[model samples]
Target: SCPLILVLGDQLSHSLSSLRDAPDGAVVALCEVAEEGRYVPHHPQKIALILAAMRHFAGELRAKGWRVHYSALDAPDNVQTLIGEAERLAALYGCDEVRVTRPGEWRLWQAMQERRDAALPWRLVEDDRFYVTPDAFADWARGRSTLRLEGFYREMRRHTGLLMEGDSPLGGRWNFDHDNREPLPEHLEAPEPPCHRRDATTREVLVLVAEHFGDHFGALEGFHWPVTRRQSLVDLRHFIANLLPHFGRYQDAISDDQPFLFHSRLSAALNLGLLAPQEVCAAVEAAYQDGKAPLNAAEGFIRQILGWREYVRGLYWTRMPSYKRANYLDGQRGLPDFYWSGDTELRCLKRAIEMTRDNAYAHHIQRLMVTGNFALLCDVAPAALCDWYLAVYADACEWVELPNTLGMVLHGDGGLMGSKPYCASGKYLDRMSDHCQRCRYDPKRSTEENACPLNSLYWRFIERHADRLADNPRMKPILGNLARMSDARRTALRKRAEAFLATLDTEPAYGQGAHS
Candidate 1:
C-alpha cells in the first residue's frame, strides 16, 4: 500500500511538499481536530475559515484523482487529535509510514517529533512554501552580530531578481518607507476590500464554530474571508487592480471612516496557504512593469512579503521555546479589561479594537502604534499581550505572531526584531488619525483629568526605563526630552498615570459585545 500523506490545517496548498509528486494510490488525510480550534481561544471566524479551507482543499485533491480521507469535526468517530487520527488511519490502511510537510508552529513540530514510531516511520518533508528556508536564513544570520531586516531584504531582492537593475535596486533605493507614511486626506476616496461570501462548506463550518466556540474573543457575523484557492486569487487580483496604485501613499495612514484604507488585506490568505508569496510578489512587480502602479507602491508591497513576513518567520524558527518568554523591559502588569471589551475612553484604541472584533483585521499601524503602544506604555506583561494578539487576529499563527508581538510590538526581545520600542504619545495618534478629534480627552495635555492616558503613560514609561535604555543610541533624543522636563512636571505626570492605572480594572463600559 502507498504511504499515507497527512495534511495539516495550515498546509492547505496543493503545491505543498507532501502533495507535490504524490505517488499513485497515495492516501491524503485531513482532519478538523478540536484541540487546534480551542488551543488559544481562536476567533470564531478564524476557526471557521481554516476548517472550511481544509474541507475545500481536500475536495480539490479528491477531484484531481487522489484518494482523500477527511474527518470532519462533527464526525461520530472523530478522534479529536491529529496524532490519534494519524494512528487510526495508518492502522486502517496497513501503512508502514506516514509523510507530512513540516508544521509551522513549534508545538506542532515538537508533537510530531515526540509521536514518531519506529515501526510506522514518520517522514517530515521540507515546507517549501516560504521564499526562504529556515536553514538558509540561519546560514545568512550566522556571522551577523545583529540580524537587521534591511540587509536580509536586499539579499532577498538579489536572490529573487525582483526590482533589481544590474547590481542596484530599481529606483536606486532599498526602502521606499519614507514615501509611504502620508496621512490620508479627508477628500481622498479609498477603495473597499473584496469581501468573499461564504459557500456551503464555509456556512457549515460557521454553524459548527458558532455552536462550539461561541464564547471566543471575536464576532462571527461579518465573516467574509476567502476560504479557497480560487477565492483568494480573486481577492489578490481585485486588490492589485483597485488598490495597489495608492497602497504606498496611504499604507501608514489611519482614518476614522475606513478600516482597510487602501491596504491589501491579504495576510490571512497568505498565512493560510491559499496564496503563495512568490506569486503575490510577481503580480505586484508585473503591475509596476505594466504602469498600473508606481515603483514606490510596488516595492513597498513586495517588501512586506519578501522582507518583513519572511524575516519574522526566520526569526521565529531561529529563536523559539525561549524566545516566547523574553521580556527585556521586565513588564509584569496584567492586560487591562479594555483589551477584550474595547470599553475605554481612549477613542483610538476603542476604534481599533472594535474593528478587530468586527472584521478580525486591523492595519499594521493600528496594531503597532495604538494597542501595542498602549501595552508597552502601561507595562502590560508581554506574554499576556502576545496571547491577545494571537487570539484576536485572523492571520495569526505562532511562527508569524510570536516574533511580531514579542519582539516588534512589545519590544520584549530587547531589540532583536526592532531597534527601538514603537512607543508613542497620544499626539502622534492625533496627528495621524481623526480619532483624537472625536475623542473627549486632550492629546496635548498630560497632567489634567481630560488628558489622554497615552500622553502621561508615554512619559511614565520613558522615566521608568530611562536607566536601562539610556545607552541605546536611538533612544538618546527621547531621553534628552525627558531630562529637559522639570522634576515637578515629571512627578505630576507619573501621579496621573498611576491614578489611571489604578482605575483600569474598574473602568466603566466603553464598547459592548464579544470583542469588548
Candidate 2:
C-alpha cells in the first residue's frame, strides 16, 4: 500500500495539493468527524452541505480509479475527531505517512505542525488555490505600518492582469463601489437560484445531519448548496446569464421580500472548493467582453473575488493567532439572544436573521449593514459575534470569517482591517431598504419610545469610541456633529440607549466558542 492522503471537508477540489499528484496505490481518507461540526454550533444546513459535498467528492475520486477510505458519521469505528480519524484510517491501511493540505484555520494549522514528531509522520503542503499565496502577501506587507486592502487589491489586479489594459484598469478606475449602492426601485426582481435536485448521496447526508445535529441553529429544510463540481459549474453559468447583468446596479440594495436581490449567491460554492475564483472571474470578464454586462458589474464582481476575498484570506493567514485576540474597543457585552432566534422587532435585524435561519445565507450588505452594524452599535464582544457569524453562514471558514467579524463587522481590531467602524444609524437602513415602511419604530427619532434602537445606539457607540475615532479622516465629520450636539440631548440619547439595552438579552445559548 502507498501513503494515506487526508482530505478535509472543505478541501474537496480535485486539484487540491494533497490529492493532485498522488502516487499509485495511494489511499485517500475522507472522514466525517463529529468534532469539526461540534467545535462551534454550526448551522444544520452548513453541516449537511459539507458532509454531502464530501461524500460526492469521494465518489468522484473512486470513479476515477482512486482508492478512498471513507468514514461516514454513523460508522461504528468513527473516532469523532479529524486527526484521530485520519490516523486511524492510516493505521488500517498500513500506510507509513499521511499527507494533507494545510488547513484554513490557525488551530488546525498549529495542530498539523505538532504532528511532525508523531509515530506515523504527517506532511503538510501549501494550499495554493487563491490568487496570492501567504508568503507572497507577507512580502507585500513587510514594511507597511498599515495593511490597507485597496493597495493590496491594486497589486492583485496588476499581478493577475485581470481587467488590465496596459497598466490601467479597464474602466479607467480601480473601484465601482460608488456606482453599486443604489436602493431598490420596487419594480425589479431577482430570478430564483438554480434548484439542485438532491441525489441519494445528498439526501442521505441531509438525514444524517438532521439526526446527528438537529439541536444546532439554522434550518435544514431548504438545503440547496451545490454539492459537486458539475452542479457548481451550472450555478456559475446561471449567475452569469441571469444575475450578473444587474449585479452592480443593485448590489447594495435591500428589499422587504427579496433575500438575494441581484447578488451572485456563489460564495458558498467558491469557499467550498466546488468552484475556483479564477474561473468565476474569467467568466465575468468574458461577459463584459461579450457586452452581456457592463464594466461596473464585471469589475465590481471581479473585485469581490479577485480583490477582497484574496485580501481577507491573506490577512487571516498573516495576522491570526494574535489577531483574533484583538479587541481595541474593549467590548465585553454578550451577543443578544435575538441573533440566535430572530425574535426582535427591529425589522432589518429580524429579517436578516430570518434569512440566516431559513437559508443559511445572507448577502454581504445584509451581513455588513444589517446584523453586523447592530452588533457593532450594541458593543457586543468580538468573540461572541465572531462565533455566531462563523456558525450561521455556509460560506464561513475561519480564515475569511474571523477577519471580517473581528476587523470589519465589529471594528474590534482597532482600525486594522477598516479605517473606521461600519456603525450605521437607521436612516441608512431606511434609505437603502423598504424594511422601515412597515416597521413600527421611527428612524428619525432617537430618544422617543417608538424610535429605532439603532439611532440611539449608534450615537452611544460614537460616544464610547470617540477618543479613538477622533483622528480618522472618515470619522471626523461624524464626530464633529457629535461634538455639536447639546449635552442635554446627548444625555437623553445615552439614557434611552441604556434603557433599551436593559430590556435586551445578550446571553449565549451555546458555550464560549473561542476564536482560537
What is the lDDT for 205 in model 2?
91
lDDT of each: 0.88, 0.90
Total clashes in model 1, counting residue pairs 3 or more apart in sequence or in different chains: 3
Ten-residue region with minimum lDDT total, candidate 2: 507-516
Error of 2 at 241 (Å): 0.4
Error of 2 at 352 (Å): 0.3
Candidate 1 versus the native: TM-score? 0.96
Against the true structure, candidate 1 has what lDDT?
0.88
| Clash totals in order | 3, 0
